[model samples]
Target: MNQVTRYSPLDDLFRGFFVKPMDFPSGMPAQQIKVDVKEQPDAYLVHAELPGAKKEDIHVEIEGNQVSIRSEVKQERDVKEGERLLRSERYFGQVSRAFQLPYELDEGQSSASFKDGVLELKLAKKLAQPASKRLDIA
Candidate 1:
């Protein structure tokens, strides 16, 4: 006799679930996210691809020791009782990313903007601290 373990319904619902209708402003998740980092001697420019995403729908935040990027995509969906949905495939939800840098950066100088479905981020590197001279006690 073989017995199948009962799994959580939560797992099964995901199998064929389309974008669930939600009141959330941004109805879509990170549809397609791509990040490009340009390393320079003085700074690092990070660019992210947010296709079908809007500037107002995205938010960027930085903490003392962390940098976080988040955004949402929105869409519309309709349903009719017992109606067959021909086809649909669109991801909707909040997307986030974070990264750490070796050198300190000037948070005040950070800037972000969206252009042609791409997010451009400009970060200015904090100036290196001068080495402190050590004096031996006489």
Candidate 2:
């Protein structure tokens, strides 16, 4: 069998910092990444780890078989006395992730929840009646 390698642009994304080490497999102020996908007979569950993200910052949308997850955050510190600016390496921008759902999911029956820096989404796959058919052998 031939080797197959699927590519995703966000696969190597870092939350806090974008730049990766040139020599070592390391990055500064590392970003959090925890994704779990579970499929049942009638539904699908998706869980994503998003730390330091607010409800207003997250935006979810589903179109056809594609589900898009996008979030944006901006942090600024005002100049203050006795406090000098130091080297900063944390991220202050937007990040997004998209996935292609396997089955057709209902838009109304799906829901999402966030707690402890985790985002959980429940998607219900629509049920279609199976058609009767006979297999043919050659």
Candidate 3:
């Protein structure tokens, strides 16, 4: 079955006026860690977007088929001698995203890297092993 929908201009104009905004008191919108995952034959590739985050502040964890990413973005407090502060629009807080994959990940073989405000992960898939082996009589 197919359904048709109609677009209204008025709905777009007042979309968020009725609902509460996610912005903070400083007028900065809440930041979220965005991620993209790709599946290969033997591994899963992940690319996470974490702007203004230091490499040391980002953490990734894998448990079986579950994967989680976390990062902390701290607001810099540097001001030049002759510069006056006007306004700031950057977000400062922790953001995290977690998800589950189809196959279990091999934590020993998985790797991660961060560059240009982007986090890349190469998660290797765990190979299936036999549950039990026959034992010979002593």
Candidate 4:
């Protein structure tokens, strides 16, 4: 059966305002890691958007069909003797996201790179192999 997908701008707007913030609890704001996954003929490309994060604060892990991306963001300012804070709205905390793929991934062949606050991962698909024979019950 053929399926058609629909795209809506309002959905994105509402999600950005509501759903994205819910990732943090107790009113403690945190940076949210948003990701986009694209599948090709032979591999999958994952693009994660992590603004205001340093390369050393990010970590990526792949196990079986699951892929996880985590990052920590820290922001601090030294106030002068006569300076007073006016307003601040930036978030500082750790955030992580995990997703599972339909196909097996070739971990050894997968590669990841980060630039301009975006992380890109190229995951190669593992070739399917026949399952081994099952042993009889004792």
Top-TM-score candidate index: 3
TM-score, per-candidate, Cα-based: 0.63, 0.64, 0.71, 0.70
* Candidate 4 error regions (>4 Å): 1-29, 78-82, 131-138
What does candidate 4's lDDT look like per residue over 1-138, in tens digits? 999999998887787685453443446555678899999988999999988889999999999889999999887876789888765667878889999999989999999999998999999999888899899999
For model 1 the local lDDT of residue 76 reads: 68
Q: Tell me the whole-model lDDT of each prediction, alpha carbons only.
A: 0.75, 0.77, 0.92, 0.88
Give the candidates in order of TM-score, highest first.
3, 4, 2, 1
lDDT order of candidates, best first? 3, 4, 2, 1
TM-score of the candidate numbered 2? 0.64
Task: Look at candidate 3 and tell me the lDDT of residue 7.
Answer: 96
Candidate 2 structure quality by residue, lDDT tens digits, 73-125: 56576778998765555566776788888887788888999888788989888
Candidate 1 residue-wise lDDT, 19-103, digit = tens: 6654445443435577888878877788998776788998877664356778887766888899987656666677778877767
For candidate 3, what is the lDDT?
0.92
1 against 3, candidate with superior TM-score = 3
Per-structure clash totals for the candidates: 6, 0, 0, 0
Error of 1 at 73 (Å): 1.1
TM-score of 3: 0.71
Q: How many clashes in candidate 1?
A: 6
